[model samples]
Structures are given as C-alpha cells and as structure tokens.
Target: MRVHVVGTGLIGTSLGLALTRHGDEVTLEDAIPTHAALARDLGAGRLPTAGEEPDPELVVVAAPPDVVARCVLGALVRFPEAAVTDVASVKGTVLAAVRAAGGDTTRYCGSHPMAGRERSGAVAGRHDLFDGRAWVLTPTPDTRPEVTARVAEVARATGAAVREVPPDVHDRAVAAVSHVPQLAASLVAARLEDLDEDAVALAGQGLRDVTRIAASDPHLWTQILAGNARAVRAVLTGLADDLTAVVAALAALEAGDDAPGARGTIARTIAAGNAGQARIPGKHGGASTVYETVRVLVPDEPGQLGRLFADVGEIGANIEEFHLDHGLGQDFGVAEVDVVPAAAAALAEGLAGRGWRIHG
Candidate 1:
C-alpha cells in the first residue's frame, strides 16, 4: 500500500512509522518543512525528492481538528484516484465542512484513531501507539464501500481494532468517554493551582491519575472541544446539574440543617460513580471483571519492583491491574496488585513467605 500522510505530528508520524514497519510505502508531508524532515529522519517515511511527483493509493489527512476538512479536501483534489481519510477526533464537523466545500464525498471517509499520549509532536510518536486501540470509521451514506475498506485495512495493519459508527454517534460517544473526561480532569486539577506547598504535598496516586491528562496540550484540546461543541456542551450540561445537586447537599450539611436526604444524596452520588467505573471495559476490551487487590509494602530502592514482578511470575498469578503509591515522608511505597479472587490468597502467602511485607 502506498500511503501519503499529511501533517507529521504525533498521530501522523506514528501512523507513518507503523505503516512503514508493516511494509507499506509511506510518504511524509507537513506544513512545516522541518516537521516533515524530522519525521523522515525518525524512520517514519521518506520525503519526495526534486522533480518527483508521488501518487498515493491512500491519503491520510492527520491534521489538527481545525484544518482537517481543508486537508482532506486538498488530498482528494491532489490524488483523485486515491481514497482519503482524516484522523481528526471530531468527525461530524470535518464531514460537514468537506460536504459544504463540495469535496468528493464518495472517496472521503472520516476516521478517528482512539489512541494518543499526553505528549505531542513527532518525537513523542511510537510505532505501537495504535496497538490494540480502537480505530473508528465514520462513513456517510455516499462513501464508497471500497474506500472504507481501504482505510480499515491500513488501520488494522497498525494493530488497531476497527469499528464503524455514524459521525454524530461517534461525536456523542467521545464527548462522554474522552472529551468530557479531559474537561473534568482539567477542572479538578485547576483547583490545586492556588494550594500551598503543604496542601499539595499530600497528593497521592488518586490525584496523579485524575490529573494525568490535565497535562495535555491546551491548544489542541481547545480546537477539539470547539469542533464538537454541541456534543461536549450536552454532556457538560448533565455533569453541571449533577455537580449542582452535590454542592447543594454539601451546603445543607455544612449549615447543620440535619437534612434527611443530604447524606443520602452524597451516598447516591458516590454509588453512581462506582457503578459507572465498574462498567468500564477491563483488560483487552473484555467485560469488566471483579479482582481482589493485594497490597504490598515495597522499599523505595532500585530493582525492588523488578524482584516483586519476578516473584509474582514465579507464583503463577496473573495480574489484572496494578498501582503504586508512595507515602509522604516515608522511605517506602505501597504496591497494589490486583489478581483474581481465587489467586489473591496464594499470591499474598507466596510473597509474604519470600520476606515481602503484605499490607492488608
């Protein structure tokens, strides 16, 4: 497959690297000449030499959300015989823009690769970024079947699982799953801005996990949120209502009102969160499974984690999830290892017998 990737940023460069590794002939291009040269240097793909006119079988427009439609349209015009696809996270807006611009709808399909790191640029791109990730194809009624198939084939070649959904459906789904969560994380993280050092020092693994995506590029995310404004606003509106109720309940408690339902309101809110968290897909996109957690005290030193992992492997216990947290002013950390309920007891016993301190 001859694939031409436009905009050699993280997704574009990563796709180029993956496709090139899969033996596809990928060509690199970007608005910034240095970015394209950097991607080519990183073994993503090659750049066109002088007097060379390269025609691609597929043109992947991996531009930012704001310019994705324009890039897709340009690709369709530049390579009339090739199928064109854009990897913008927001699909509905791009599709509408292309349609309004009189682009060839049959040869253009919008796609979203549900994979990214908090980092950006070609330097942060990895060939395996899309491994086992979902790549959604949002095709309109006029999209040629062959065009969709061609894009799916290339996506699968990068080890992504392909799924099809309507553009509006894709936007709504991501608003809840991706966009809203980013906003929530950012909102929560914003509260820590004015905190004193003492208050911030008490941060734990929970805070780290919550604020991880808060490190995302604000410029990029702003474009994404604006592109899918309607869907994001709908989800945020529901979230605002829930937050208002929680705040009112807290205020009732603070005023010593002894409100009969205040506690119940808080309890229900937390319970609802638990239910939603539990419904999240488990490892490898499987149905959620309950696992018992085994907490161990790990010394804060080199090679301790590797030894623990080796011991766990020796015990023949499959780890379903894992988390590590360091205590404030302590020389050790807690390693929370989650395994099947049946394996928890034996794994704990094995680790304890090997001079490991097992925390309850």
Candidate 2:
C-alpha cells in the first residue's frame, strides 16, 4: 500500500515506520517541513508537500484533536481516491466537524489507539507503540464501510486489536479509563511539589507508580482536555462523588468509628481494586494474562539473563513478561519475572532448587 501520513509526531512516525517495515511505501507530511524531513531521515517516510498530489491508498491524520478534522477532510478532498483515518482521541466532535466543513465524511474514519507514553514528537516514536493496544474506530452513516475497514487493517498491521464503537461511546470510555487517570496522576504529583525533605523522603513505588503519567506533556494534554471537555467533565463529576465518599470514610476512621466495620469495607474495596487491576490486558497483544512477579538478583555479566530465560523454557512453561532495574554500583540487578499464577509456585521452586537468587 502507498500510504501518506500527516502530522509526523509520535503516533504518525511509528505508523509510518511499521508500514515501511511491511514493504509499503509511506510518505510523511507535516505542517512544519522540518519534522516531516526529520521523520524521513529517521526511516519513517518521505516528505510530501501540502499542495502536492497524494497517491495514497491510506492517509493517516495524526494531528491534535482541534486540527484532526481539518486534516482528515483536507486529505479526503485532495486525495479523493484515498481512504482516510484520523488518530484523534476525541471522536464525535471531529466527525461532526468534518460534516460541518462540508467534507466527504464517507472517505474518512475516526480512530483512537489506546496506547502512548508521556512523550511526543517524531523522535519519541517506537515501532512497538501500538503492539497489544486497543484501537477503536468510529464510523457514521455517511462513512464507507470499506474505508473504516481500511483503518482496522492498518491497526492490525501494527499488532493492535481493533474494535468498532460509536463515537460517543469511545469518548466516554476513554474519559473514564484514560483521561481521568492522567488527571488523577497529575493531581497526586502536584500535592508533593511543595513538600520538604521530611515528607519527600517517605516516597516509595506506590507514589511513583501513581504519578508516572504526570510527566506527560501538559501543553498537549491541555489541548486534548479542552477538546474533550464534555466527556472529561462527566468523568470528573463521577470522580468527585467518589472523592466525597472517600473523604467521609477517612473522617470516620479518624473519629474511631468502628474500626472493625471500616476495615472490612476498606479490605473489600482493596480486593475489588486488585480484581479490576488484574483484568488489564498483558503486554504485546496477549490476553488478560495475570502474572505473579518473582524478582531474582542476576549478575551484570552477559548471558546471565539469557540462562535464566533458557531455564524458564526448559520448564516447558511460558514467561509472560519481565522487568529489569539496575542498582547503582552493584554487580547485580533485580529481574522481576512475571509468569502465570498457576506456574508461579512451581517455577519459584524450580529456580530456588537450581540455586538462582530469587526474591519474593
């Protein structure tokens, strides 16, 4: 397929690279000439000028939400034969905008991939960005079914799972699952900004984990939040109600209101959270696979980690995922191995019996 990608940022560059790897000729374009040229130099795609004729089977508009509609509509008019898609987080508004602009909505589909980092720009693109992520496509009455399927085809090529959902449904679901989490992360991190060493010294992985997304680009998120204000506002309203209950619960606990009763409720809530967290899909297009993490101290020498994985293969079971965090000035770092819960107990025993340094 000859593909033309607009707005060669993280998502666009990643897609272009993936398509190029698959033997498709991809041309990238950006409002800024430098970015398009840079992406081409980085093996993303060749740059195409705005006024040039586009010979594309697919045109992916990867701009911000506010500009996505215009980009998609423009592509539809310029390359009338091409099927178009936009990687905009908000859907209903963009689709409506295309109609209001008197553009051919039939040739374009709205898509949102449920994956990204706290990063942007072409340099931040990774070929594996969309791997294992959910990509939602929204099509209206005027949209051609084949064009919408073309978007799904590209999504599948990048190892993404495709699901077709209504525009409003996508916005609402993303507000609850994605946008709300980003805001909550920022809110938690914001509370720590003014704290002194005494308070800061108490930081741990829990705080770090909750605040990780706070590192995301605020300017870009500002645009995103503003564009999807209605959906985000609804999510925020629900969160406010939950926060009120939580505040009351904290007060009740402080007032010594039946610790036994309160503890039971808290315990149940924690358990529910555990259950919900476990439902999150595992890495790289896998199922809702759960893993019990067992950290092992491995030497900083070559083949040490390889030998560990070779041992895992010897056990005739699969490893779900693993994380490595190197300790400063140490000969060893911790490799937290994630395996299916059913195999966790036996795997731990096998590695322990083999005299490998295993940690809980």
Candidate 3:
C-alpha cells in the first residue's frame, strides 16, 4: 500500500513507521516544518510537501482534534482515489465537521487508535505505539466496502485490533475511558501540588499511580475534553455520584457511627469497583483484566524488593506487576502486587499464610 499520513505527530509518525516495516510505501505530512523534517530523519516519512498530486492507497489524518476534520476533508477532496481515515480521539464532532465541509463521505472513515503516550510530536514517535491495541473504525452508510477494507488493512499493518463502531458510540466510550480519566489524574496531581513540602514528602506509589497521566500535555487534553464536552460531562456526572457515596462512607467511618452501615457501604463500593475494573480488556483483547493489589510491607533496604519477589515467587502464582509505595516517615514501604483475577485471591491468601501482611 502507498500510504500518506498527515499531521506527523506521535500517531502519524508511528503509523508511518509501522507501515514502512510492513513493506508499505509511506509519505508523512505535517503543518510544522520541523515535524516533517524530523519524521524524515526518524524514517517515518518520504517528506511532507504541499500542492503535490496526492496518489496513495490510504491517507491517515493524525491531526489534533481542532484541525483533524479540516485536514482530513482537504485530503479526501484532493485525493478522491484514496481511502481516508483519521486518528482523532474525539469522533462525532470530527465526522460532523467533515460532513459540513462537504468531504467525500464514501471514501472517508473516522478512526481512532486507542493508544498514546504522555509525550507527543514526531520526535517522540515510536514504531510500536499501536502494537496489540484496539483501533476503531467508524464508517457511515455511504462508505464503500473497498474503502472500509483498505482502512482495516492499514490498521492491521500497525498490529492493532480493528473494531467497527458508530461514531457516537466511540465518542461516549472515549469520554468515559480516556478523557475523564485524564481529568481525574490531573485533579489528583493538582491537589497534591497545593500541599506543603512536608505533606508532599509523604507521597507514595498510590498517589503517583493516580496522577501519572497528569504529566500529559495540558494543551492537548484541553482540546480533547472541550471538543467532546457533552460526552465528557455525562461521564463526570456518574463519577460525581460515585464520589459522593464514597465521601459519605468515609465520613461515617471517621465519625465512628453506624459501624455496620459504613462497612456495608464501603464493601459494596469496593465490590462495584472491582467488578467494573475486571471488564477492562487485557493485551490484544486476549482476556479480561482483574488487578488485585496485594499490599506487602517491605523493609527500606537493598535487596528487599528482590526478597519480596522471591517470596511472591514461593506463592506459586504469576505476578503481573508490582508497585512500591514508599515514605521517609516509615521504615517499611508497601508493595502492591498485581496478578490475574483467578490467581489474585489465592496469591493473597497463600502469601498471608506465610507471615506476609497482604492487602486487597
């Protein structure tokens, strides 16, 4: 396939790299001169140029939310022979914008690769960015079968799982999964930023985990969340309701009133979270995920982490990952181990029986 990708940032550049490796001819285009030059240097481009006759099998628009539709619509108009797709996170608005601009609907499809990094730009592009991730294609009734197949072929070149969904459905799902989570992480980190030096000194892995996505570029998130405000608001409404319940439960626990009621409320909330979390698909959609965090107190010394790993090894279950929560105030930090849902319960039980203080 001879492919042309516009907006040579992380997504476009990554796709260029993947397509090139799969023996497809790739040409990268970007509004920024440096980005185009960088893509060429990084081998994700044949070089971006304007006013050239666009001849390609597929054209992927990997632009920012604000300009994605305009760019893709322009590409489709100029290259009627090629199938066009976009990797914009927000879909409904982008697709509408293209329609409003009189783009070629039969040859264009809205797509989004459910993968990214805190970083952006052609320089930050990686060849394996979309490997084993889900890439959704939102095609309209007017879309031709050949165009749809070509878009799927491009997705497969990146080693992504191709799924078809309506644009509206994709927008709502991303609002819940991606956009809202970014805001949540940012809020967590922002609250910590307001803390005093001494208070922040007690920061641990749990806080870090919640706030890691906060390191993402604020400008990009601003565009994303604002572009899909209604969907994002719907997701936040649900989150606000859940938070209200959790707060009430904590308040009851603190006041030491209605012990049974508080326990029941907290248990139900935790169970709901666990159940919802288990539905998150694993790598390549191979399995459903259940991450049970088993907290173990580890001494703050050399080889202590290694010993914990060995101890976890003795439990005879696979450890998917481990998190270290540390503090200067305590001599020991908590290690949260992640295992499969089936293995999590037994791993926790077996480790606890061996004198390990494990938490769920």
Candidate 4:
C-alpha cells in the first residue's frame, strides 16, 4: 500500500517506520522541514519533492490534538481519492472540528493507537511501538464501510489490534484511563521536586512505575488535556472528591478518635482501589491472572541471569513475570519469578535440587 503520513512526530514516524518495514511505500511530511528530514534519515520514509502529487491509498494525519482536525481536513483535500485517518488521542474535539469544517465524511476516520513512550519527536519513534496494542477507530454514521475497512487495514498492517468505537465513548474512556493517570503521575512527581536527596534516594520500583508517564512531553499533553477538557475535568472532579474524603479520614485518625466511621472509611477506600486495580486487563487482553512468586538468589554476574532462565526453561515452568531486586552492597540479587500457582511448588523444588537457594 502507498501511504502518506503527516506531522513526523513519534506517532507519525513510528507509523511510517512500521508500514515501511512491512514493505509498504510511505511518504512523510511535517510542518518543520528538519523534523521530516530527521524521520527520513531514520529510515521511517522518504520526503516527497515539491509539487509531487501524493496518490496514496491512505493518508494518516498524526498531528497533535489541537491541530489534528485541520491536518485531517488538509489530507482529505489533498488526496481526494484516499482514505484519511488521524491518530490524535482526543477524538471528540477533532471530530467536532471536522464536522464543522463540512468536509466529505465518507473517507475520514479518527483513530488512536494506545501506544507511546515517555519521549516525543521522530528520533524517538520505534517501528514496533504499536505491536499488539489496541488501535481505536472512531467512524461517524456517514463514514463509508469500505473506508472504515481501509483504515482498519492500515492499523492491522502495523500489528495493532483494531477496535471500533464512537468518538464520545473513546474520549471519555481515555480521559479516565489515560489522561487522568498522566495528571496523577505528574502531580505525584511534582511533590518530589523539593524533597531532600536522602529522602529521594529511598524511592523504590513502585514510585518509578507510578511516575513513569510523568516524563511525557508537557506541550503535547497540555494540548490533549485542553482538547478533552470536559471529560478530563469530570474524571478529575470525582478523583478530587475521593482525595478530600481520604484526607478527612486521615485527619480524623490523627486525632486519636476511632471517630465515627473514620477507620472504616480508610479501609473501604483502600479496598475500592484494590478492586478497581484488579479489574484492569492483563497480558493478551484477559482478566488478571493470579501467579505465585518463587524467589531465587541470583549471583550478580553476566551469565547468572541467563543460567537462571535456562534452568527455569529446563524445568518447563512458564514464567508469567519476573523481577530482580539487587541486594544493596552485595554480590547477589533476588529473582522473584512468577508462575501459575500449580507450577510454583515444582519450580521451587526443582531449583532447590539444583543447588539454588529458595527464599520462600
């Protein structure tokens, strides 16, 4: 397929790279010449020459949220014969703009791929970024069925799992799942700005996981949050109310009164959090699976990790997940290998028989 990608940022360049890797012809463009040049140099795609007519089968507008609709409209006008799609995170606002523009709707679809890094720009693009990730397509009532199929084909070509949803539903869902979480991460990370070095040094993996997305490009997030302000504000309001309740409960507990319902309030809040977290889908888009951990002492050497994996493979125990925590100032680390409950005992015993220390 011949494709044209606009905006040369992480999403656009990544799409170009992925499409090109699959033997598709891709042309890249950006508002900034240097950006487009960088994407081209990175083997994402080639830049079209002046007055070169782009007779593409699909045109992907990968602009920021604020200008996504405009980019989509421009692509539609330029490639009147091509199917057009945009990968902006905020769908409702972009759809509203496209509707207001009064452009032909039959060939346009708004899509968003739920994949990204904390970094931005063409230089940060990865061909495999969208692999096995959800790519949402928002097609209005007037969108032609064939046009929608074409957009879905583009998504699938990049190894994404395509999902069809309405613009409003996509906006609200992302506000709760993506936008609000980014804000929460940034808010938590902001509190560490003025903390003492010793206090910061005590941070663990949990803190790293929570604040990881806080490193995203602020300018882009600003535009996205502004575009979806209504939905994001609603989620934030509910979260604020919960925060108020938690704060009040903590204050009451500080006063040494098993005050009316204070303890229960705290417990209920924590329980609710756990319930919500457990509902999140796990690997391969299934409900979270319960796995038991088997801790093994791993010597801090290059081949030690490989040997551990080889040993686990030899035992035929499928590792669901693993984490290695280094023992401070020691020459060994703890490798917590998670497996199905049924495999836990056998894995532990097998490793113990092989001269490996089983912590638990």
Top of the candidates by lDDT: 1
Tens-place lDDT per residue, model 3, 1-360, is: 999889888888889888888889898778987787788899886873566765898999898889988898889888878999889888889888888888889998888898998778887888899998889999988889899899999899899989999999999998988899989998888897678998988776677788888898878888999889999999999889988887888888888866557777778888988888888876446567656667887878999788777877887888776767775677988887888777888877887787777654
Ranking by TM-score: 1, 4, 2, 3
Q: TM-score for all predictions? A: 0.96, 0.84, 0.81, 0.94
Instruction: List, residue by residue over 1-360, the lDDT tens digit for candidate 1.
Output: 999999999999999999999999999899999999999999999999987867998999998888888999999888999999999999999999899999999998899999998889999999999999999999999999999999999999999999999999999999999999999999999999999999998898889999989998999999999999999999999989989999999999998978779999889999999999999998888899999999999999999999999999999999999999888889999999999999999999999999999997
List runs of model 4 lying over 4 Å from the truth. 327-329
Going through the candidates in order, what is the number of backbone clashes in each?
A: 0, 1, 0, 0
- CA lDDT of each prediction against the hidden true structure: 0.95, 0.85, 0.85, 0.91
Give the winner by lDDT: 1 or 3: 1
Runs with alpha carbons beyond 4 Å of true place in candidate 1: none
Query: Per-residue CA lDDT of candidate 2, range 209-267, in tens?
Result: 79988988888889788878999999899778756666667778999967556665566
Better of 1 and 2 by lDDT: 1
- Report the lDDT of model 1 for residue 168: 100
By summed lDDT, the worst window of 10 consecutive residues in model 3 runs over: 282-291
CA shift at 142, candidate 1, in angstroms?
1.5
